[model samples]
Target: MQQDIRDKFKNYKEENVELSKNHSIKFEALLQQELHQNKPKKNYIKWLSVAASVMLLVSIGIQFYPNKTSEPIITKNDNDTTTKQITLGNISPEFNTIETYYTNSINLEISQLDLSDENKELVDSYLLKIAELTKEYKNLTQELNTKGVNDATIDALIRNLQLRLQLLQRLKKQLNEFKNLNTKQNELQII
Candidate 1:
């Protein structure tokens, strides 16, 4: 039985199996053709990637580039004093006085604010409101310039300044209250 199995194995090993002569050649040709076909596409992709990178760099540069021209400064020459022209506040000395008073008071209040880190956010919010009012005031000034000084415009301007000062005063009081509350809480915690 062993001899018979060995003979069968020998017969199987000796069987002639003829592979197609063109099989490997055809495969090689197909591979070469595919490589050639993809060459241009790879080049195209490479060029596109480079172009996209260049565009990205250019856009970023443009966004971050500093402006070249600066605003011109106008200086007054005291020695060459000509007759001073009357301007907005010059129209009414009382209006100038009111504006100066309110502005100085608001500035003093701002300077006195507790600018600690804890109060910073609150202060910033108050400043934002003041800035908005200031913008409105600027618009009113522009209107006054264009329409020439009217009582209503002057009143609005003064009112805007007053509102800014009042806002600052309120913010100061609120901050003080907050500080006092914090102090009391700290004391309680200690006790």
Candidate 2:
């Protein structure tokens, strides 16, 4: 059927066809109408883009502003003295960099966790320990502010952060092992 159609088309000859006298004029009018219609859409998109840019600038500005309540707070103690709660990051730029790196990594790991009923118990136990460490970290920061900076306190704070990260890593490793073991058991049952 396709071959017959192909042969018929091959045998066909071109024949001139006449267009209406007003065809070019109508086509030009249509093109003008389309161009005018398209222009308003482009302007709408331009305004939308401008709005997005303004919002982005405002958001970036807000990000740079210091957040007061969620973090270290200033408390006035004794006679006419304001003392801000001390933190590891506030201690030094180096400590701040280290602390930031560890915090970001820990948060990233937690965010990526694959939570399921199979790993709930394990995850909960590890999280409980992390919570305890977090409390201890807060205590040590308080101690640092109260008794002033000590080598032991600094070391303990650093260690606490290390332990939290390590616990998350261990939890991840155990979850992977559990999944692999379960997969193998299912494969065995299938056989």
Candidate 3:
């Protein structure tokens, strides 16, 4: 069968049959029909690309969207007036963590303090200083709320937090020394 087909092809070529007037147009039409049959697969990919772009745009939009929860909340106080709190955390998440860390550390130091009758005067003095610093911090916070965030205010706020922590640490150290000296004196008396 292969030999017969080959022989027929050779004979036809030798005959040199001329093409019809519209042969090119007919072939192009058949080719287009065949190509169109395969085009649905490409169309599916095109739709997929469109869908992926839409999804990408939606994701980007969501990423850039501002969150409502991050805004400051106003609450009514004992005087039946609303007050909005502002802090370093209000500026950014990093500030919030820093503020929280320093505040917690200060509280932890205070909680760990050893209070006794002998150290009462010393404790009162340290507490008074801390109270003054606390008052100053509140004033700075008010400044921040009124003036908005600036390099000076932010630096001052962070510096204030650092000072409070340092003061607490020094108080702890002095109390430790005072207790140690009292122990040595007690030993000498016992001897």
On the 0 to 100 scale, the lDDT of residue 117 in model 2 is 94
| Candidate 3 ranges beyond 4 A from true positions | 1-72, 75-84
Candidate 3 local lDDT, 1-191, one digit each (tens): 34677676776745668999999999999999998775444578899999999999999999778655454654559788666767786788678777888899999999999999999999899889989988999899889888888989888988888999999999999999999999999999999
Question: Which regions in candidate 1 have their CA more than 4 angstroms from the true location?
Answer: 1-88
Q: Kindly report which residue stretches of model 2 are placed more than 4 angstroms away from their true locations once superposed.
A: 1-80
> How far off is residue 7 in model 3, in Å?
62
TM-score against native, each model: 0.54, 0.59, 0.60
Of models 1 and 2, which has the larger lDDT? 2
- Candidate 2 residue-wise lDDT, 1-191, digit = tens: 34677777897999999999999999999999988774444577889999999999999999877644234545869798778777888776677777888888889889878889988999999899999999999999899999988889999999999999999998999889999999999999999
TM-score of 2: 0.59
Cα error, residue 42 of model 3, in Å, equals 20
Q: List the residue pairs that clash in candidate 3.
A: none
lDDT of 1 by residue, 81-128 (tens): 643332345565566667668888999998898889988899999999
Summed backbone clashes in each candidate are 0, 0, 0
